[model samples]
Target: MTERQQQRSPSSGAGAAPAPPPGDADAESGPTVLGFAPDTAEDDETVEPVADGTAARVAVGSDRLAYVRRPDLVGGLLLLLAGVADAASVWLPWDRDGDVSGLSLVVRAVDAAPEGIAELGRTGLWQPAAVAAGGVVLLVLGLLLLRPARGHRVSGVLALGVALAVAAAVVGRLVDVGWDARSFGPGAWCAVAVAGLGALGALKAVLTAPRVTTVPAERLLVG
Candidate 1:
C-alpha cells in the first residue's frame, strides 16, 4: 500500500496508541454530561438560616379591629333631670317670705354694702342661692358631656363634685339658721333632692364606662 493509505488505515498499529471505548472516554472528558440531579447546595432564595443561639423575629403590626362599649341611658337621664332642677331653683322662692326668690337673694348679696354683708349673712339665704347658681352651671356642663356618652369619667366626676357642693351649702345654711321646714322654702328642698340624684347617677356612669382593646393579626409568608 502507498504511504498515505497506510497512515489512514485502521489496522495500522505501529507508532500509534490504542483508542479508548466511547463510554469511558465520555465519562472522563465529554462535555461534562450536563444533567439535573438532586441539587445538594442550599438555596439562599427559598431557605433562611438563623444563628445557633438566636431566634428569628418577624415584624408585626396592629392592623386589627377594635370594640367600643354601649351608652348609659339611665345615667344620662338622671344628669339631665338634675340640670333642669338646678335651673328651676333660680326662679323659685328661697325663704318663707314669698317675696324673696333665689335671683333676688343673689342680687341683694351683690348690691349689699360692706356693713350690709352681715345682714345678708344673717338671713342665710344668699349662700344657698349662690350655690344654686354654681350647681346650674356645673349640672349643665355634666349633662353636655354625658348625654351622648362622650367623656363618661369626666362628667361623672364633675357630677359628684356638684353633689358635694350642694350638700355642703344646704347643710351650712340649716346649721347657721335652723333645721325647721319653716326656715327653708321649696327651692332649698329641690336642691337637696338634686344632690342625692346626681350622686347616684355619677356613680352609675363611672361604673359602666367602656374599655377599648386591640388584637394582632397573623402575617402570610411566601417562599
Candidate 2:
C-alpha cells in the first residue's frame, strides 16, 4: 500500500479513532431498556386546577369587613325640630304684660309645656334672653351629639346642664308658690310640672344620641 494509505488506515494507532459512542436517544432506539422513570411532562398534565365558587366567595369575604353607616335620617329630623321649636319660641307673640291675673292658666300652663324651655315669660327680655341662651347651648350640644366621634363626657355634661336648668326652673316655681302659700298654691305645681317635663325631654335627647364607636371606618372617617 502507498504511504498515504498507510497513514489514513484505522490500523494506524496515531490516526483519529471512531466518533464517540451514540448518546441517550440512539441508545433508546436500539433496545427496550425501560425501568421505572419519572415522566415529568405527564405528571404536570395530571395536575389540573378548576374554579371553585365557594373558595372564591371565602376569599372575597376575607378581603372585606363590616361597617355601620352613620344615622342621617333620625339626626336630621331631630335637628330640624329643634331648630323650628327654637325659632318659633323666639319669634312668636309671647309677652309678659298680657295677664298676670291668669298666671295659673296661661303662664304656669305654657311654662310647664315640654317646649317651654324656649318660652319667653312676661319676666321681660332677661328671662327670654336666658331662655334664648339655653336654646343656643342646646343647639350646639345637639350638633355635637350628631357628630359620630364626639366625647361622651361632652354629651353627659350637656345632658346634666339641661336637666339641672329644667329642674331648677321647676323647683324655683315651687318655692315661689310655697313661700306665698296663701296666693299661688296650684301655680307652683304648674311650674314644677313644666320644668320637670322639659328636664326629662332634654335628658332623653342627650343620653340616647348615638355615642358608640362600632367599626374601624367610624374611627378612621369621623375624626
Candidate 3:
C-alpha cells in the first residue's frame, strides 16, 4: 500500500499476463518452418477436392466396347469353380451302389473296349472321357480369363461349347434310370450344376470384359 512498495506490486507489470516463450506457440500449434515463408491463416473459401486425373477420350464414332474395361475375375472364377466341380464329380457317387464315380466310369469303358466286337454286350462299352477332358479345358480357359488379357470372348465361346457338350453327356447317361431305382446320385447332379455354372460364367466373361485407354488431364488448384 506504500508509495515505494506500490512500484513493486504484482499489478505493476501493466496488469497484463506474462508473455509465453517464443517456441511455446509453435510447439502448441505445430512445428514452424523457420527457413520458409511464414504461413498465412487458412482461407474460408469453399472448395471441391479432386486429384489430377486422366480420362480416356474416345475417338469419333469409335466402338464403345473397345473403350470399356472391366475385370473378368468374377466370371472366370465361376467357370473355374464349374471345372472344379466337374473334376470333383469323378470322386462323387453316380449309381445306387455308390460304386461308379466319373473316373471309374472312364476306367470301365477302357476295360470294356478291349473285348471283341461280338462280346460288346458283355463288355458294356460306355465312356465319359470327353466330360473329364472338357472339364480340364474349361479349367484352363477359366484361369486364362481370370488374369488380365484380351480375347475373353474367344475363351467364353469355347467354354460354352464345352459346357454344352458335357451337358449332353450328363443327360444321355440319365436316360436309362427308371423311377423305381435310386436314380442319379450326387455325381450326376454335380455334372449338371457344372454345366449350368460354366454356361453362365462363359457368358459373363465375354460380356463383362473391360476396355481401357488413357487421355491428357490436369489438376486445377482451388487455393
* Candidate 2 regions with alpha-carbon error over 4 angstroms: 1-83, 95-126, 150-153, 170-202, 205-223
Comparing candidate 1 with candidate 2, which one achieves the higher lDDT? 1
State the lDDT of candidate 2 residue by residue for 103-157, as single tens digits. Answer: 2234444555554543434332233333334445555555655554433345546
CA RMSD, predictions in order: 12.1, 13.8, 17.9
Distance from true location, Cα of 212 in model 1, Å: 4.2
CA lDDT of every candidate = 0.65, 0.42, 0.70
Q: Each model's TM-score, in the order given?
A: 0.57, 0.35, 0.57
Better of 1 and 2 by TM-score: 1
Clashing pairs in 1: none
Model 1 Cα lDDT, one tens digit per residue, 76-101: 67766776777666678766667566
Error of 1 at 96 (Å): 3.5
Give the alpha carbon lDDT tens digit for every residue of 115-155 in model 3: 75444334332426556677788889888887666548888
Total clashes for model 1 = 0
